[model samples]
Each structure stands twice: as structure tokens, then as C-alpha cells.
Target chain A: MGVLMSAIGFGIVTASILAVSSVGFTLQFSVTNVFNLSFGSVMTGTGFIAYALNTSGVSIWASMAIGALCGGVISVALNWLIFGRFIRHGISRFGMVIVTIATGLICDNTIQAFVGPTFYAYNAQPGKAFNLAGMLLTGQELIIIVIAAVMMTATHVGLKSTRLGAAMRGLSVNASLARACGVPTRRVVAVAWFASGVMAGIGSVALFLDTSTFAATTGSQFLIMVIAAAVLGGVGSAEGAVVGALVVGLATEITAAYWNPELKDVVAFVVLILVLLVRPQGMFSQLSSERTAVG
Target chain B: MSAATQLYLATVSVYICVNVIASWALDIQFGVTGVLNFSFVVFQAAGAYTAAILSLGPSSSSGGFQRYVGGWRLPFPVPIIGAMVVGAVLAGVVGLVSLRRLRSDYQAMVMLVVSVIATIVAESQTGLVNGVAGISLVANPMVSLIHATRQTQIWIFVLFCVFCMALVGVVMYATVYSPFGRVLRAVRENDRAIEALGRNANRHRMQAFVIGGALAGLSGALLVEFIGAWAPNGWFYPETFVFFTAVIVGGRGSLTGVAVGAALVGVGVQQAVEYLPITLNPSVIASLEWIITGILTLVFLWTRPQGLLPERRRRFPTPWRSDAPELAERSAATKGDERG
Candidate 1:
């Protein structure tokens, strides 16, 4: 029972953060049709932003917001400046993949240069813990869970009701068709970049809050897990991303708890391979041959 | 030259040659065949580990700097043989599991996962490849035969590398001309059409993957021999991208381009580092180098995706431009040679 409850606690925490980042990741993929490997770099950027603000005497919440805003701004800039130009040039999906990787390397190492070569703590105070069924839990973890739930609900409602959300959904389904229908497709894509950036920022801060430290390579290292969650959940489906996150989080935590911790990461990768092999469309989605075609 | 300076030159020279070969191995696999192959570094790691273990003799019962398997102080040639065999075996296993018909992105992900798994295994299992402590390979095979002078060692190693590169080049050239190479290209160009023609596309892809893996392994063995160290930190997924950058920057599907790319991006960029002032932090300079490489790759993609010398397109001759056939004929012949 103790093991089960602790695992549940781990699952919830993991799922919350995963949902935030994966949703942003999927949103960007859906709208832009770019895999955006550099998304993880932006996550690190936000992490550093929050770290910088906190060091300069800001509350964690305010720092999180600033970091998210920074991410939003950077995302918009990248789309406007770099990726959009490449897309206009008729570069293939493979080319875009390489571009994203190059962009990521640039961002990661630039940060490494500025931050030096060591991990630094964000200096956020750990809050009081509440024991729930023999699991040591923190207030921040609960807050993150709440944030995730709120974000998911708000995102669902926005997509279904708001004009902007409808435009985004239409664009995601068929960009050319949406443009033909006069959905302001370019603006929608830009909004997506902004939104994805915000989520990446908030999610990265939450990660740092949980771990209480930051490093240049933190986002890059954590990105493999994020990619696993996003791809496993279904890249274009926000809801699928959340569900996928929950499953992956639970799987990772349980494996770490019961088996060798050294093998936890390897197990996560194995899960990624298994998911791709078993259900390319995701756990909840209907079988669509298009799902397995490409990213 | 002073003995120490000569030794330094030797080491650096060996480094360049080793990386050039490794980069070529990657270029042929990825650039020519369009395989992402994120696990490229692992093959090199395997070869290094194999060569190191075979040349390290038995593990100490009580204490030792590094612990590994198949400890035997084999002669120089034997270690190279061991490296090639290990690479072939590992490549076969990886190819069997991952070279099936799959989405390119999915294939890339699988390779990445394999790389990560290999790193974790290397780091965690102390009994396996010394568990991040790594094995320090000794350059003792020819110690008795040679005078053991730094200049002699440098020249001999340089000769060894050149000989290996020539051998690899001949083998690769032969492969490019072979029927198998044509089939591989056919599969790469259009697997569905090839399948209609009754060729087993997946099998061809697996064959290419395994052969590429062996090349990578050979390169790795050569590298470890020069450096005398084989560690987990040596092989990272990003290193794969460095080669990708080189191949792309030079030109894909062209041997000249691949070599030029390796020379420019792989060696040229590193050489550029020598010009940087010593006052600035080394890490900062390194970071700037990566950023530059990344930017150049992007700029090349957006503006000149075809590269400095784009893969030449074949054209039929017309009365207006009668010289087209001559150009085409020359290119066709070169392309034929390149395929082999």
C-alpha cells in the first residue's frame, strides 16, 4: 500500500509537469507542422529566466510568469525569423529537422557559455510537506497539479468556444484549407508559438521548482522524456498528450521504485519504442494510417 | 622538432584522421542513404571498447584503474581485427532490430533511444567498459619492435591511419559500384517501386546499416588507439549531429562534398579555434564554436540546402545547349564511380 501510494504521488507530480510541456509541444507541432526540437532549448531559456529573476529578488510565481513571457517572445521570434523563412523556401521535413537540431545546439551552448559549466540552484524555498498515506508530499507539487488541471480545462474550453481557438483547430486539421476558409492561418501559427512558449516556460519553472536547481543541459536531458511523453500521447492531440503523460509518469516512477534506478531512463526509452511499435496512434485515438506516416 | 612537440603533433594528427574517417562513415550512411542514425557514436564506442579490452590484458583481481571484459594484451593487428569483428556483430544486432520499414522520424527516435540506452548501460554497469571510469589503452604492441620514440610513433600511426582510410575508401568505392549499391540506392530513392521490382528493401537497408556500423567501429578503434582512453563521455548523441552538420554543409550524396564537409566543418572549425584569443574562457570559446556551427547549418539549409557544390542534376542535351551531354556524361561516370 505504501509503495502504491508513493508511486501515485510520483505519478501525479510527473503527469502535471509532463501535461504542461507536452500540451505546448503538441500545440506547436499541430499548428506549425515542425517537430521543433528546439522546444527543449526554449524550456531551458525559461528556466534560466526564472532563475535570474529569483536571484534578483522576485517571487517564484512572478518569476514563472516572466519566464513564460520570455519563452513566448522567443518562440514568436524564431518562427518569424528562422523557421518561417525556411518553410517559404520549400525545404523538406528532413531539412527542418536538421535546422531545429542546429538551432537547439546554438541555444544550449550559448546558455552554457553565459551560465558557465556548473549547475546552479534557483534558491526557491521548499514549502511544508503533507504526509498522505506515507508519501512525503510538497505544497508546490499540489499547486503544479492544480495548474495543470486548470490549463487543460481552460485549453479545452478555448478550443471549443473561442474564435481564436476555432481558428487554431481548423488550422491544425488542414492549414491550406483553413487559409482558404479565411482563418488568418499565419496569425494562428504565431499564436501557437506564443502559447507553446508560455507553457514551456511554466513547465520548466515547475521542473526547477521541484528539483530546486538549474543547468544549461537540464532541458536537453529532460527533453528525451518530454519527447517520449508527447509522441506517446499523440503529437496533434492535447488531450492525448495529458493521458500519455500520466501513463509514462506512472511507468517511470513505478520502475524506479521497484527496479534499479539506473535503468529507469533506459526503461523510459524502451517504453517509447514499445509505444511506437504497438500503437502509433496513441492509446485513446482511433487507428489512422496517417498517424504512423510521419511527424 | 622537439620530441614533446612532435608527440603533440602526432596525437592531433591522429585525431584529425580518425575523425575524418568516422565522419565519412556517417556521411555515407546518412548523407547518401538518408539514414539519420542517431546511434552512430555507439558503434565507435563499441570498437574502442573492444580494442581497449583486447589490448589491456587481464583485469586486476584486487584493484585496477579500469575493469572490462576480454582482457588480453594482443598484438596491434589483433586489436584492429577485434574492433572490426565487434563492430560487425553489434551492427548486425542493431540492424536486425531497427532497420525494418518504419517512418524516418520513428527510425531516428529508435536510434536515439539506442544511443541513450548504450550510454546508461556503460555508465551503470561497472563490469561493463569500466562503468564511466573507462579503460586506458596502452600503446605497447609495437613497443618491442619499434624504438618507442615519439617521432617514430607519430609517423607510424599516421601511416596506419592513411592505410586504413585508403582501405576503407577502396572498400566503399567498390560497394558504390556493386549491384548491392545500386539496389540500396533504388531502395533509398523509392522503396515501394523497388518492392514492386521484387527487391527486399528492408534487407538492403539492414545491409547498409550493418556495413556503416562496421566503418564507424573501425573509426572508433583507431581513435581509442590514438587517445589511449575509452570512456562513456566520449560518445554522445550530439556528436552524431556534428557529423550530420559536416555532411550537410559539404554536400550530400557526393564523396567530394562529404570529404570537403568533413574537412571544413569537422577539422576546419576546430582549427579555427586556434585563432581565438587565450584570454577568454575556453568553455565560452567552445560554446561560441557550437553556436556558429549551428547557425551556419541553418543558414545553409534556408538559403543553400543543396550546399557549396550541389548534387549535380543530370540533363538531356538539346540543340540550344549541346554541351549538356558532355557535362552529364562526365557526372554520370563520376556518379557511377561514387556509387561503388
Candidate 2:
């Protein structure tokens, strides 16, 4: 019973991080209609930026903000420079996927060349553990949970209430239709890239905080799980991402606790395969006609 | 040629042959069938591991270094044949699940996820092909049959690889020219149309996938035999991208083009990048190779998507046929309309 509760606590913490990253991933996919495989490399790049900042004596909070800002900038640059050009040149969406994968290779290797391959430790020390209802948690984990909740709430409110969010949502549903309806799609897309990049950046920091040690391939390693969560939650839905993350997180942690720890990552792949096989449109997706086909 | 130069040429020849075979395998899948099989390296790895274990003999429980199934001490051709069977079986299973239910993009993502999962499983479960440490010191098949020096043995191996390459090329060429090849092209152009024509498109894809997997396995077997080692790191996910890039750069749906592309990208560019006198660390140089390949793929897709030698028009009738004009005209029109 104690082990189960503690696992659930850890699961919640993981779910929080996954929610942030998965939502960000789904957001990009929603607006750009590109899978954005390089999103993982962006996460790694921002994580390294935060690491550099922390090593250079910046406050952790400040470093996170700066890292997120860098992420947003880079994300927008990628969209504008690479993906945008490909789209303009009439590259198929599948071709865009290949292009994004290439971009990921470039970004990941560039980081590897600069940083080398050794693992770097995040500088923050863990605070005292707090127990609530037989579930023990650390101060950092608690903070992460709170931040995730706040971010999710903020995203929800923004999407529901703000004009930009509405435009973003409208664009995600149908870019041409949204443009026909007088939505500023180009600007909305840029905003979507920025917003998603910010989430990825902050999520990377939270991931680093949770894991403490990371390398160039760390973000890429986590990418599959993020993709799984995003796809499971329904590719374009923010709330669906959170729900998907919770399910993935709980399933992974519980499986790790009960089964072999080495199989933890395998659980996510299983879930992804199952979801793809059962419902490729995702569980919460309302759009039935958006069926993907080979070009 | 000097011994060192001879050895270098031999090594490069072997690699070129292996990559050509693998590229052809990928060409059948991606270029001909339009299945973006991102988990390609997994099938190749499976073949390598299967061949290694079969030739290495049974794992000794006492040898605390590594563990794997089957130490059958199979002879020269048996292990290689075993690899092909294993590769085909694995591909059939994977294709069955992925092709039946998912769309192309989702299928590609699932394959990518599968590739990663396979890697993780290999790394974590040390018992399976000895995990990340991998199986090493695999003896060259039939090395004892020839009473020759090591250099001569390597030359003989090079000849063997050349023969294998020629055999694969001939078989692939035949397959491409056969009626089945036309069906594959039709499926690639429009599976829905093929289905509407009362043919199972998915079945055709699975057949191509399995055939491709078998060829990939054969390539892996040949490669492992040459290197005398197999490891998880050797078959990374990005490795699949390298093959895909080769097919694209070579020209899709053309066997001769695949050969040229594999030679240029797999051997020429790779060797050149590897031998560059950059002051960076070797690992960085390796990373640079991937970066260059990625950039190369993007540039090709952007500038000349048809590649340098675009696939030739599929000939419809043999020259012996006197009534070829109408069929030829129809084929020419269809060829112009074909987009894959």
C-alpha cells in the first residue's frame, strides 16, 4: 500500500512534466500540421541553455525564464526558416516530417559537438521531503506540480478567453477555413510556435530538475513518451494531453514498480502502439474526417 | 597496388556492396512500395544478431560476459540463410500490425517508436544478444577452408561479398522488371485504386516489406561476417535515415540508381567525411557526418526530388512483340502521369 501510494506520487510528478511537454508538442502539431520531430532537440537545446545559465550563477527561476525565451525564439525561427520554406515550396506534409527529422539531427548533433557527450548535473539541491497522506514528495516535486497546474489552467483560460488563443484554435481546426474566416493564420502560427516552444523550454527545465543529470540525447530519449502522450490525448487537444500524460505516467510508474524497472520505457511504446492501432485519431479527438493517408 | 591500399580498397568494396544491398532493400520498401519503414535498422540488427549467434555456437552459461539464444555452431551459408528467415519473419510480424491499422504518418511514427523500443530492450535485457555490449569475436564463416594468409583471406571475403552483391543485384533487377514490380508501383501510386481494382493493397505492401526485410537481413549477415562483431550501437535509428537518404539521393524506384546512390552516399560521402582532417574530436566528426547527411537529404528533397538519375520509364512490352505501339503509347502516357 505504501509503495503504491509513493509510486502514485511519483507518477503525478512525471505526469506534470509530461503534460507540459505533450501539450507543447500537440500545440505545434495542431497549428503547423507538422509533426515537428525536432521538438525534442529544442527541449535539449533549452535545457542546455538553462544549464549554462545556472552554471554561470543565475538563479534557477531566472535561468528557466531565459531558457524558455530562447526556446520560443528558436522554435519560431525553425518554423519561419525551415518548415515555413518547405511548406511554401509545396513540400508534402510527409516531406515536412522528413525535413523536421533532418532538423532534429542537425540540432541534436550541433549540441553534441558543442557540449560533448558527457552527462551534466543540474545544480539545484533537493529540498526536504514532505509526506502528505502517506505519499512522500520533495519540495521541487511539489513546486513542479503547482507550476504544471498553473500552466495548464493558464493555457485553458487563454485558449477559451483570449483572441490570440481563439485564432490559434481556429487555425488548428482548419488553416484555410480559418484564413477564410478572417483569422490571421500566419501570426497565429508564429504565436503557436512561440507558445509551444515556451512550454517545451519550461518543461525541459522541470525534466532536468526531476532527473538531475542529462546529456545531449536526454531530450530525444524522452521524445517518444511525449509523442505517445500527445497522440493518446488527441493530437490537438490541450486538456486531452494532460489526461493522456496522467494515464501514461501512472501506467509507466506502476509498471516499473510492479514489473521490471528496465521495461518502464517499453510501457509507453506499448500504449502508443495500442492507441495507434485502436484509434489513430486519438481518444479525445472530435475531428473524424482528418484521416491521414500516404502521399 | 601496395598491401595497405589493397586492403583499404577491399574494405571499401565490401562496405559498398553491403550498403548497396541494404539500399536496394530500402528502395523496395520506400521507393517502390512507398512505406516509410523507419524501423529498418531493427530488422537489419535482428539479422546480424541471428547470424552471429548461430555461428558463435550456444552461449556458455559459464562465460559471464554475454548471453543470447542459439549457439548452434551453424556452418557458413546456414547462418546467413538463418538471418534472412529471421528478418523476414520479424518484418512480417511488424508489418502485420503496423500496415493493417495505421495511416502512413502514424505508421512511420509507430515504426520509429518500435525502433527506439527495440534499442532500449536490447540495451536493458543483457541476455538478448548480450545487450548493449553486443556479441563480438564472431569467427569468419569458412575461414578454415582456405589455406591462405590473413590478407588473402580478406581478399577472398571481398570476392565473396562482390558475388553476393551481384547475386542480389540480379535478383533485385529481375524482381523490379517482373509483373509484380508493376503492381507494386501501382500500389505506391494509389493503394486505394489498387484496392478498388479488387487487389489487396495491404497484402502487396506486406509482401514487399517481407522481401525487403529478407534482403536487409542478408546485408546485415554479410556485414557482421566482415566485421566479425555485432552491437546495438551499430544499428541506431538514424542509420535508417542514412539508407533512406541514399535511396532518395540515388533516385527512387530504380535498381541501378540505388546502386549508384549507395556508392555515392554510403561509400563516397561517408568515407570522405570520415577521413576529413578536421581538428574536432572524432565523435564530433561522426556527428558531423549525420548532420551532413540530414542536410543532404533536405537539399535533395528541396531542389531535385527525383534524384540525379530518375527512375526510367517502366517498359511495358518485350521488343519481340510486333504489336507494341498501342501498349507503348499507353505506358508512356501512364508513365507521365505516375507520381510517387
Q: Which candidate has the highest DockQ of all?
A: 2
Colliding residue pairs in candidate 2? B57-B71, B58-B71
CA lDDT scores, all candidates in order: 0.78, 0.86
* Per-residue lDDT over A58-112 for candidate 2, one digit per residue giving the tens place of the 0 to 100 score: 9777898899999999999998888887787777656677888989999999999
Native contact recovery (fnat) for each candidate is 0.68, 0.60
Q: Each predicted complex: what DockQ? A: 0.54, 0.59
TM-score of chain B of each: 0.87, 0.93
lDDT of 1 by residue, A60-102 (tens): 8899999999999998898888888777766776777788888
Residue-by-residue lDDT tens digits, candidate 2, B1-340: 8899988898899999999999999999989988889999999999999899888877884375668866778778999999999999999999987898576777888899889989989998888888888998787774865878888888898899899999999998888778898889888888889999999989999999999999999999988988888888988788898898899898899888888999988888878887787677888987888888888889998887777788887555768878787779877887674333
lDDT of 1: 0.78
lDDT of 2 at B269: 82
Query: What's the true lDDT of residue A183 in model 2?
Result: 87
Question: Which pairs clash in the backbone of model 1?
Answer: B173-B340, B176-B339, B176-B340, B177-B339, B177-B340
Q: Kindly list the per-residue Cα lDDT of model 1 for residues B59-147, writing each as its tens digit.
A: 78326766776588787788877887888788788776666655666577678778888999999988887888788845634454578
Q: How many residue pairs clash in each candidate?
A: 5, 2
